[model samples]
Target: MPKNSYKIPSSLNRSFLDHEVALSGGGFQAKPLPMKVLLFWSGSILTLFWVASSTFVAQAAWWLIALVVIWWLITTAFLGQYSKTKEMKFASVPALLAYVPAAARRVLTRTSTNPSSFYSVVGIDNISATGLIKYSDGTLGQGYLVVGSASILLFEEDRKAILNRVDSFWRKVDTSCEYTFVTTKEPQRVYHQIANLERRNLALEVRDPELKELMDEQYDILNDYVGKQFASIHQYLLLKGDNLESLRRAHSVLQAEVENSSLMIKGCTMLNGDEVTDMLTVLYKGKSS
Candidate 1:
């Protein structure tokens, strides 16, 4: 939990290994430049420039030849410079690297007119949860935005808040624990299901018959916070685990964590929602009565 501490729990460590989930094979992807892809777009732009020069400006044949030469020189020179700068940025950017595997696209994505292979950028637009991105060698990869470990520090409510926490987590994760993000269409409604039950049980706990509805409302927010934790863990697993064994282990760990925080998670049964509710009610009543 400390800023500098890099240790993971025994079970979580096993889960990480079991998943074998890595965003990249190495420090960075080494895809080569896709010259043909680059040429297609660059050629289109050059053609337009030539047409404008000849038709609008009344440039003669020799002038046209000179313009083409100038365009090639400028394109090639700029491309070379761009590639060097991009490599530099990729190698040095701190905390920012968290977004690289997904955010950083290879040079081919930009369709840059820079004739040099080194002048390409990772991607030209903003990074996001899901978007098609082209790599330097013209291979297209989907952007996968994820929720991070750090996000667990704060409770998740909205998608943006969840994303920010995920962003924060990846920035801190020195290890290979990949994080992920997702949204439920009915987060609020689903959250209230457990919350309503918790409040119903809590109300029965005390005979202070005053402000029952008000008391229930007060607990509503707390319940929502608990629900968000569940959602975060679920999304995290989906992003990290691609195999059945790993998902199974992750589910086990999640159930254990939920039970460890029993008061909030309401006993954290391994059973499905219906069974969980039954167990929660029985446990709550045993204590209340």
Candidate 2:
């Protein structure tokens, strides 16, 4: 029998973050405390105290000692789980409140001034572009959003890594489509060519004011949904101690809602070729040759 092999798509493979890219402009490098070392030392000290108390000082019964050990183990496990979940909650809350809103407004921008950091883009465009880049320093993963003028590109990797490569990729695409744009004097034609090369063919233009208004309404609904979902999770975590199942359920529902919102937003924002062309022209009008 043939062995089964699972392959992650190239877009999802973000091993590049492990090694420094030549073109990566420097960004901030996070210098978090060595959590593992702290945890190890704390656990060791606690274990020693527990053993000494059970064996030498208290002379506790076997049953009592066993119960103490069991309790210690359970407490340690619960604390570990709680700590992880809390970190995730903290990270997600800001994205829900700030990042999503900014992206929806289409005024979101990223500053990769740090020599060791990058950010990611999220949300969908009219071209059905939605993906995230996950960046990892072999221990932590950060996500970045990919935004484009005509068609967005999605990847499952870190934002910093994507940002590092963005210039090169944009230049390559521009080189490929420049001739078409210059010859035809049509931004749409260049957009189509670039989209074709990038394997993003779904392009829509939104000219209807009513449809745009409706999409904005739907975006409001999605924002409300996210807020409610987050609140429920927060309440559950506070009232009940770090219920993993509850967190998972909340996240699952939110993910589904976000996906639905992406589709809806894409449909509502679909821009025709002319509109896309004009937008691109305006955006790049200030660029130097």
Candidate 3:
């Protein structure tokens, strides 16, 4: 019998359970703390101790101490929830009683200067038809909607390789430019698209009973999924440049890398001006984009 020869696959192609992406120095860092939680807690405790140890504190009326305790409890609860919210303050007990009316008045008094509007918060000075977003600070940005998946079907090694490529691309890009990857959830809207397709192909479906039955089955599956209000996950890539030229360069580099590399990115769509606007509106206002 003739000798048999077999080829062994490369170790890089072997499936693994997990992988990690290496990052360049300064590519990412821990968030800075302006003030420590421990410091705040220490200060609060010291203040309370100073007050309670005072001569008048011991001689204070019972009702007065009870009122003070109630106030402290209320303020502590409020601070626990809204400490980071600067505009919201616990003015007094009277203010709490009038919260509803005060909230209505605040709504009436809201203005563009307060960052209540999408444009103000987003700082978009202009949006070009070609999908470049110009900011008030002279930065230019572009957004891309990414579609892809990672599941049991995709080996762990493959997932890591794709992530490594993505990390390399980020390190290769201009350091001054800002790049962000965001994942969000939205109500499923794909069923509507399927419904529209079914309507458009009604005549074809009528001519082929088999096709009609298949289409109906698929539509029902999607419709049932939608009826459950299961949120669909969306991924986005946002690139901001110091200037228009830098933005264009970054966009080209991204497109080339994504197309040439096996990053497992199945689809990427650049958002137009209107689409960008709608996206921001939906994000800020909780409305459909």
Candidate 4:
């Protein structure tokens, strides 16, 4: 966690065995220009020719032709230079020719119908009491809240030890099962404390005047801080397997790793039904209800 300390070398690496057959049976090159860039440039070239031909037929002004040519050169040159970067390799074409037209067609041909429920769309059947989430496809998953890891506050040597333990933990994990780690910032319900305080004040049968004034001041302070509170970062880990038995095995391995092999994890609390629902809402809907 230190700014300039040594990093643990990653144990996860692509195996040549995985790509051996594909490499030998070659079709397209391993890496090429993104499809979106190819499409955009192709469309640009066709549009350029079409405009030029149409101008010739209409006897357009000479300045018009020069302006179009200059614009085309500038755009193509700029894009060509920009596309040299690694990020542009995954660029997508504009939605005007694809998504926008499809959306417009859908609107024009709209029909009244009930929308599908969120659970149906996400393919989640239920979250069990013991923190197992059963999906429509029969997969069982368990979610855990990573409460805290204090590696950032540790000295250099301690941080390195934590990193080594983390690496060992990953290496010892069951590779066949699926695991996902997510980190996100979610807004905390800072208004709840004030609301609860107000409720308690109202429910009191006998309240001292002095105590009441202090409570009112407390409520005012909390109310003022409501919207200014910082969002808390949450880290989650999901372990998934094909069936209950495999899921249990994975969970055992996870517990063992945390207790015996890893010093990087401070706590891992399993999520119940409500907690699972809240986590899902934060992940997909971008806010927790």
Candidate 5:
């Protein structure tokens, strides 16, 4: 007999994960639901009551049950959309509570459904966007963003390595004197852009309004400071001229003040903001620039 070759069919792809959209606490980190007798029997009893509550003829009762089933399905499905995406925390507890709910409200403002493909958190300022990152086991990761899932797969996973790379670029400058800094203004333009982007594209819908705004605002503040700090450094360098050691000392003291002030603002962090402010005062007494 001639040689016969048989091919095995591949199974359909059905993973617990939704690769296209990976939000914080990815791939069903949802708490295991409490499936007690109350939930099970309550639903069952309600279902039975809903069916038997009707006193029409058998055929008519069947029609009524069908109608009820359809209605229940619609309501549950619609509500399910809202509950799909969970929120994350920011700096303050109040901010966390306020913004996340806002993000959800923003989502509800337009469509009844959540974003189809991706997940996003709109910061308070709106300019700083953290692209969704993933850890190896599919957790919400922190690092540089990878554009696509294919890119995520191809680039090779190095979460720790990339995070360290980000850490290396860190520059924390301290200032001894009070500075003219712009107070934070919410990014109205970016806010609208995000809304417009979500609206124009049916693929990605925003989930929480308040949370998005908080993120957007924080981004604006960070962005505004970034340039000012660099300029301040440049100005100091220019004014110092030949005295590099004095400049270094001034910078160090200023840095310490900053570290202190940061602690104050953060309250529980490494240094208090008041401590930073005090150091800055001392440095100011010693140097002019």
Candidate 6:
């Protein structure tokens, strides 16, 4: 394989669909405020100020009171409609009253769990793999591997060096291997067990106290793992056409290298391709039926 061998198809060149996947070198575009929204907010603030001023003066007119009442009703209606339409949860009266204390407690207990680095998938450029990864802690040790489009790109802080390495690595890869040994047995069993558990009405079931607690704990663990695996598969599925195939190959390579201490990079986790693929297949089958 040469640096110029792998070309990104035109179909896979669209912006990422996932909110979690950030694009490299792209900044957020500032959308202009609509004229109607601006006017509504301005009128709201003016009306609120008028109501306050009238209260202070102790000469509130009946007309002024009526206007304030109308404004309040309109504001409430607008907020209610917006929340309902957007499926947003508005704070209840009790929740609003308790918000201050809840917020304070949250601040006190907040843990610093942010990742030390951020990585984004940059598609191939007709030659080698390209992507951007930034380290918050600046201890950029070994390069990170991104698996997708049946290809793997080893990326480091140094752009030029990583590009060269990607080119060199691809040349040595035996692309002819059909990767015919995809093992879905374990993943299929997990998926079937998950489906069976989901269909069961566990909430109504009676069991021994100790057994119930242990079962609940195990259920939670399995559910969490399945969710993570599904998410990983969904992210890969976002890649269109041939890109998906490339990802499959890349994932296979990375899975083998996961336990290699010298090659494993910090702040990155390689997902199991076989599990993701099997889960996806099962999901598609369920959806179709």
* Among all candidates shown, the one with the greatest TM-score: 4
lDDT of each: 0.41, 0.36, 0.65, 0.68, 0.35, 0.40
Error of 6 at 205 (Å): 25
Worst 10 residues of 4 by lDDT: 16-25
Over 4 Å off, model 6: 1-161, 178-221, 224-230, 234-289
Best by lDDT: 4
Task: Put down candidate 1 lDDT per residue, 10-73, tens digits, no spaces.
Answer: 4532322123222346577544433432453466567756765666444567777668667866
Measured over all alpha carbons after superposition, the RMSD of each candidate to the real structure, in angstroms, is: 18.6, 22.5, 14.3, 9.3, 24.6, 21.0
Worst 10 residues of 6 by lDDT: 116-125
Q: After superposition, how far is residue 82 of candidate 2 from its true place, in Å?
A: 11
Candidate 3 residue pairs in backbone clash: none
Deviating ranges (above 4 Å) for candidate 1: 1-62, 77-178, 183-187, 190-237, 240-242, 249-289
Worst 10 residues of 1 by lDDT: 121-130
Task: Give the alpha carbon lDDT tens digit for every residue of 54-144 in model 5.
Answer: 5442346667777766776565444333222321111134755676765544532224666431134321111113222232232221111
Question: Model 3, range 11-48, lDDT digits (tens) per residue?
Answer: 45323321223333666754332232333334556666
Clashing pairs in 6: 3-127, 148-246, 148-247, 149-243, 149-246, 149-247, 150-245, 150-246, 150-247, 151-246
In Å, residue 174's CA in model 4 sits off its true spot by 1.6
lDDT (tens digit, per residue) of candidate 6 on 59-80: 6776876676777767655643
Better of 2 and 4 by lDDT: 4
lDDT, residue 87, candidate 6: 23
Candidate 4 segments whose C-alpha is farther than 4 A from its true place: 1-121, 148-153, 189-207, 216-228, 286-289
TM-score of each: 0.26, 0.20, 0.50, 0.54, 0.20, 0.23
Give the better candidate number (4 or 5) by lDDT: 4
10 residues in a row with least lDDT, candidate 2: 232-241
Query: How far is 177's C-alpha from truth in model 6 (Å)?
Result: 3.5
